[model samples]
Target: MASGLFHLAVFAVDGGPWEGPVSWRKAVTFGLSFGLTLITIAWVSSFVALGDRARNVLLGVFAADCVLEVALITVQAWRRVPSHFNMETALDTTISRMLAVGGGVLIVVLVTLTVAAFRDGAPGAAPDVALSMRLAVRAGFVALCGALLSGAAMIARGVAEVQTGHQQAAYHVAGALKPAHAVTMHAILVLPALAWLLTFTRFSEARRVRVVAVVSAAYGAAAVVVIGVSAIRFATA
Candidate 1:
């Protein structure tokens, strides 16, 4: 997070449009996004019953991958080159492919954690808290999966355009899903935090669960609308 803030400060001082692939915005956004995501995953995973060694290994790899991805983006931004779908140079291509692979690793780790969340339940908590944690974590992970798929779509479309000799179009078209991608990615933190906050209230377990359900439904609906619009735009682009 501090690194992201520093990048933001630099961006402010340097003053550039935030729309391009090589913009400082990419570095700042990825840094903050992945950093917060790492923290959220670690927190949420604590409620799951993964053994200590397994948890450590999974999170270790996840954390390292996040850092690597962000570092690559930051490096490319500093080099004044696009970080994704840029095949102009061997180094750029390698970095772009590594980012894609990092995304796959993220999906695997989160899927494993999500499965554990469902399978083990939140041990050593009150029933209400347990239920809230379970629903929040599950729903969050599902939304996160949506985010990942949308990201993959963006990369695929961008790479395809690049391959077809439409380099500039690749950047424009690849961002078609950015709105949906951003909206869906943070559900893991928002939904779980909401559930946790409700636990401190006087609502019964059933009421809390009901509230979480309603919120999740609303979130899902919003995600669907964004995704539909983005999909249309992507297709047209």
Candidate 2:
């Protein structure tokens, strides 16, 4: 999943700030998408009354975000297929709208849950345990779908962007498109982590396994920390 997300974020990153419509659109889309996401995460971390549940639910929360975003984008795609088949602008708008909805969902879920957490844990009557459970469940489902769909979108974009970037200019304008490039590199590590988690390996060399374990944990932890920071930001904001 992380591999897919990394590719998604980086695919078209080779384009400079002044590329064609697709490139320009991608830049704007990613700028707002990624920027706002980071902000949300930061806020949540800073202000949310995160408890053991929130602190330990990293994978679940991320999954919810991915699900929400992907569902929105898919809806937009379904809408644009007929009338706006030939209209690139319409298609772009659809994608943007989907992303916006996804962002909105993230904000809502994080903020609401965090707020509830504050209320539940604060000095008051017994916290609404049942309600909290329901919310957490809902959040997890949203995160799962959101992560999968958004990851796919990002992977497709990354592949396209990288190809286009190579054709447009050889390492000339990797700055403006840095996000794509960064995600592509990130895929290398993330894919390995997924493999480690999802697949069984018969390794003759114990050292290799150890190395993989160490490196993957380090990389994954670092990425989670970054995401955690973003979550904190969202809570506060």
Best by TM-score: 1
Superposed on all Cα atoms, the candidates' RMSDs to the truth, in angstroms, are 2.0, 14.5
User: What TM-score, to 2 decimals, does candidate 1 have?
Assistant: 0.94
Candidate 2's TM-score: 0.28
Please list the C-alpha lDDT of all candidates, in the order they appear. Answer: 0.87, 0.41
lDDT of 1 at 212: 94
- Using lDDT, give the best candidate's number: 1
Per-residue lDDT value at 23 in model 2: 30
The clash tally of candidate 1 reads 0
> In candidate 1, what are the lDDT values of residues 1-237, reduced to their tens digit?
777888999999998988787789998999999999999998887766677777888999999999999999999999999998888899999998999899889889887887777664344422333687688888998898899888889888888898999999988897889999999999999999999999899999899999999999999999999999999999999
Runs in model 1 lying further than 4 Å from the true structure: 121-129
